[model samples]
Target: MSEDKSNRVVSGRVVSNAMDRTISVLVERRVKHPLYGKFLRRSMKLHAHDADNACNPGDWVRVEQCRPLSKTKCWRLVEIVEKAR
Candidate 1:
């Protein structure tokens, strides 16, 4: 099947990779506060499908939105941007 190029993509660090073929990614973004107009850091944890279980904790990776692979997983591993240092 052809992959969707318009799918959302995010870069983050892999926080957990204990699951069989899944990894938890922590995506952080800075947003300005509505009232104060001060930029603040915010983060979210996303479950991404790792078909080969190639990701490990601390790895920087890119994930792309995809069809749901499980109850909480709708993202797929795209590439490892940087390895754990």
Candidate 2:
């Protein structure tokens, strides 16, 4: 039998709208500094697919990892967690 090995993709919200059909997602991670003992604020920008143009800034959303959608897009929006309020 073949084994399933699909990894769980991460989720984030749109942070910027500098490109067409694309949104900037701020992904946070905990990382200790070389001189510090506790974790610090670390973030990354992820390019996600927004085919419907429904995503907007300050809207909470869910994104999943997928095959490269474009030269810089590697994630797709799964759902809208919350709208800008």
Best by lDDT: 1
Q: Tens digit of lDDT per residue, candidate 2, span 1-85?
A: 9998775577666898678878888877779988968889788889998888888898888888888888988888888889988
TM of each candidate vs. truth: 0.91, 0.80
List the global CA lDDT of all models.
Answer: 0.96, 0.83
Over 4 Å off, model 2: 33-36
Residues 1-85, model 1: lDDT tens digits: 9985799999999999999999999999999999999999999999999999998899999999999898999999999999998
lDDT of 2: 0.83
* Candidate 1, poorest ten consecutive residues by summed lDDT: 2-11
